[model samples]
Target: MKSQMLPTIFIMTLALSVCGVYSGKVLVFPIDGSHWINMNILIKELYSRGHTVTVFRSSGSWYIKESSPHYNSITVEDVAGGFDEDFLKMLISRIIQIQADGKSSWKRLQVEWELMKLGPVMTQMEINVLAKLLDDHKLMQSLRDAKYDLVLADPVGASGGIIAHYLNLPLVFNVRWTVHSEGHFAIAPSPMSYVPMPMFELADKMSFLERVSNVFFFAFYEFQAQFLIRPLWATFTNKYFGPDVDYFQLIQGADIWLMRVDFVFEFPRPTMPNVVYMGGFQCKPAKPLPQDLEDFVQSSGEHGVVIMSLGTLVSELPRRVVEEMAAAFAQLPQKVIMRYTGEKPSTLGNNTLLVEWLPQNDLLGHSKTRAFVAHGGTNGVQEAIYHGVPILGVPLMFDQPDNLSRMRAKGAAKVMDIFSVNRDTFLQALQEVLHEPFYRENMQRLSRLHRDQPMQPLDRALFWIEFVMRNKGAAHLRTESYKMPWYSYHSVDVILFLLAVLATFMASFVFGIKFLCTKVCCKHKSKLE
Candidate 1:
């Protein structure tokens, strides 16, 4: 009997260990491309912790797969006019053409105008997809029946918040950009004075002219959000969620904001209680490179290896630009690993290896890596900071320039203008980053600071996510400021009311003084008579 009891106890213990004490169902709605990459990391972690995860992706999604061991997938069908690879490539090509035309201010304005046009197109496409998902009665019913503990979303697309509100589930945002602007601009007290607008490439410590441009860019984004993006989302939310529902307010009402930024990368700014900085959460210690790659890297000897990747979307550049880049790489003593899919440049050197894709993090982590040549995406910048590798940035478009600007301001990077960069300029920039001690020193300092946290960024993000699920919602951490009207939230109405009271008091005091003078004069006149 004692032996039988021991076996039963062993079985119970094993079961408990495999399936943890608590588990919650999570529903993830993520944007595709690089954003999905970030979200997928969290989903895997959630699965490892004994929780069930479901991911929502469109049928035409480029990066997201239908099946994964980490989580189940929910594929929405017939997402028309979606932002696909071909479409993105065309847009990128057009932008590159415009930039390559010349570096005149007019050319710059044309680029800005072109980006502004994209605002309406992207917003409309997102709303159309949201409508299709919400209108599907069967899908809606299935989601409602699932009884998810919380809804995690990237608020770049508005459906996540709207659907979460519809299901009456707790909402958590893994965010950097909301549809309106940067996540902080939507929820925090962002003063344009110090907080530089995104994409303008201005630093926190701005000169007078820089601040003017900052405010101008702020207004430009505000106009796009108010006049372009908001109307479409508002129309959709009115139809599905009701006329009373405001999508912007729904976004602001989220339980937690796992901000994809930290002070080490972003400028210091005012933030809220619910805003958790998980900058570099997706980064980890670099693993060993594959054998072939390792052999090549080891062959770099004293000079070490240099890596170049232009993020996910913009893989290839114009042939002329590609040739110039190749020529520049040919001159470097350092071994070059470039992720390119374009035609091989005639100037390509034996030292440079052009692969379709390389393990970016692993290469950066290698001790042989001396510097990185990259298109400054958020993920790449954070990874470089994590690995303590300096950068020579060739920013292509949209937030890439701004991302590089921050690194340059921090003394860890040197940025080049894609429009004007020829072989000579490109070669000069790379040599500076490679030879300079300060660039390496500065980036290593940032890496030290980033790694010296009590909890890893990923762990902190996971803890807050679990905390929200356990408590049903993190209402205690979230502020009720979103409910207030714009005037009330800014205290404009209160200021007006105080001004009215002051005016009334001053008028009454003046009247009292006039009345006293009249009475005294009348008494004196009567005495004289």
Candidate 2:
């Protein structure tokens, strides 16, 4: 009986070790503030589910340090030496130099500037440079030593995707906004369609000229892929890593793509098989607003409060714009709190207060805070929606225009061009949003829709992660479309049909001429006989 009991105990212990314990490690890379927030929530969820999580982020990111107690954090060093400062100086010097030069040189400079203005192309170039840095053999050896089972990367991180390819591990990509899906064959709508171009200016729509511009933009991307990106990536991978690392292979290695956008704010579109929409994962009804903030709102009397932020990256707006905004707020009946990183404006009025930073979620959730004036970043947009606050978006760059346009189309916000912005238009837009209850009602309706999903976004993300681990890769869920030719993917069969029709018409014309010539010769021969 003692021997039998010993055997039973051994079997139980082995089962517990094998089945209940997971040894897999997940490495996450978030490049910016928004990505940091999204990945932090995902890391916490992964940790609670009994997986070890590690994070890599940019050096200056605040959220990475804030999340140290929750997960292992590593900062990517700025290896380019004083590159950022030097780069800015060079840009300014070039501009001034070109201005002093003759018209031909200035025209050349303008052309170069236009090339830089193409956001997607510039982003791709930056991604290529980072990919080369990450492909260094030393870095690869270090990652290999870590023995991670999977790598989770933000698409914007650039290097992570390439590193995952080198390590031969399953990679999951996180896109924090809508425009990241451009050029990828996915069901998501191209948010770039909403961004107005200089050739075509309209609200909530793109014109024919805009469509033509997009075609040229797409062509430019392809050009970069063939000429710049492909060669650079190949050389880096071959020199430091191995010959097997290729651009197409890097894209194919991704097991899943996660987007941080809710379906409520976006229209239903065809989605790829492994693509998942997990937007608003970080949003929740946070703890009550601080007592002082609440008291301030309560003391504002019948007039409401306005929450204004330029987001993290663009925290310092031009001083003139700040003064104009302050002056505009002075006239409005609302109590305004502006989040500015630098010195406060000199003309700040009685109804307004300036702070370096405010707890954004807490302020947005306050009942007195009726509207948000924001830079149209995804994090800010999601928080505004979650708290049922309307927005007046002053888009800066990249996807902000598209994000703002989508909100306006939903009847939940208004968009103001930042360059042309002033006190009168700003005040009128603010009053319209606060005076009309429709904006608030629309936001609430969208919030309910977003919150009505079958599973909480974080839980859904966790389930997918576990599912991928258990299955040893989610490759079965991936689509064959990834293997299809570019023309086939975009459905160019109609063009082929038109070409075929043209060919048949030309053939029939040649055959008719031959037949007529033959008949004329035979008739002439009969007359001679």
Candidate 3:
């Protein structure tokens, strides 16, 4: 009896040790500060659940690397060094070129459009290069040596996905936007519009002309990707590393895709098994507002305050636009805090304070804050809606314009053009937004809808992650899509075949009737004679 008891105790001790070892390694890749915040929240949640997490990020990212003894940071180089200057010049030139060419320069215009679309893809490629660089720097080698059980990555960072692919670890792709009906994923509202495209908005609902236009669009992207972007990535990889690498393969192998959009913000649609919506995961009440911000809000009193931020990507606004905004804010009765990274414009009035950085979530959560002036970034838009704050969106590019348009259409927000924005227009928009109770009501309604979930978004996301891990790839969830060819998938060949068969049948029937009529006419003529 004593020997049997000793054996059971030893087995229990071994099991505990194995569980502890399994919980000690999770590798995360965060490309930007927002991603850092998001991943940090997730890591903290996992840590509380008894899992260890390490983050790999660029040095420029704002997350405090040394804060936690458990947290380890691996730095990557800034490949886009001084790129802001070049990017600004290029943007101006492209805008001018688009205006000058109009519809006449279709080919060149298409090229320019493709280049714009390729922005995110190119950024990912650069990240992939950076990942390989990190690999050489001994970070990836250490991770491999450590034998991490999972590799969680932001979709924007190529290294995370690439390393996961190479290491044959479970890979989770985190998306920060809504998924589209066309199977393409959008990170934010396509600077095109805001009201989410419903599931009914599929290719079948389009007119014949619209379908044709879509064909052309798809063809253009395919051409650009195959000829330009793919080649560029291949060349970079080959030159940097050796000939053993396959650039395209790295993109195809994510085990699971996680999205940061909620059903309230986006329409419900049939999604691939691997795609999971995890939006609003990091949206929780944080610490109190800074003393200075608190004092400023108190100073505003009954009139309340408006918080403005254009997001990190477009931190530097055009000087003219800034001046116009300053003039507009000067007339507004509400106190305004604008987050601007550039030099403080001399034209800003007493009502407006230009700060280099402000805690956005804290500001939004403030009782005195009534409205948001934003770029309609996914995070910003969601945060505004979550906090029940009305918005005035000055969308600049990509999904921002689309997002703002949707918000405006929903009567929850107003849209202002970035290029031609001025004092009068800004003032009127502000007045309408501040005075209108409907906007706040609508925002609150959305906030309620967003929160009416069966499970917290973070929990749901984590469950899916563990589900995939436990199920050994979650193959049961995958659509039979991998089995079909492109033509079959689109049903183009089926349509073409049916059209051919119908055409043949019609031609044969028409010819047979014509021959019969001719014979009857001859017989009738002979009988008459």
Top TM-score: which candidate number? 1
Better of 1 and 3 by TM-score: 1
Residue pairs in collision within model 2: 187-270
Least lDDT summed over 10 consecutive residues: which range in candidate 3? 186-195
Which runs in model 3 stand beyond 4 Å of their true positions? 1-24, 57-70, 75-144, 177-219, 232-253, 480-483, 493-529
- Give candidate 1's error at residue 223 in angstroms: 1.4
Give the root-mean-square deviation of each candidate in angstroms: 2.2, 6.5, 7.0
lDDT of 2 by residue, 244-303 (tens): 556555665578778777667554445667877787777877668778777777878888
- Could you tell me the lDDT of residue 527 within candidate 3? 100
Taking the tens digit of each residue's C-alpha lDDT, what string does model 1 give over 233-315?
77887787678889999999999999999999998999999999999999998898899999999999999999999987876
**TM per prediction:** 0.95, 0.78, 0.74
| Candidate 1 global lDDT | 0.90
Residue 101, candidate 3: C-alpha displacement in angstroms = 16
* Candidate 3 TM-score versus the reference: 0.74
* Residue 255 in model 1: lDDT: 94
Model 3 Cα lDDT, one tens digit per residue, 108-223: 45545755565545455465546456458475577678877778877554566666766778777666521112223321212112222321122223555655555565455556
- What's the lDDT for all of these models? 0.90, 0.69, 0.68
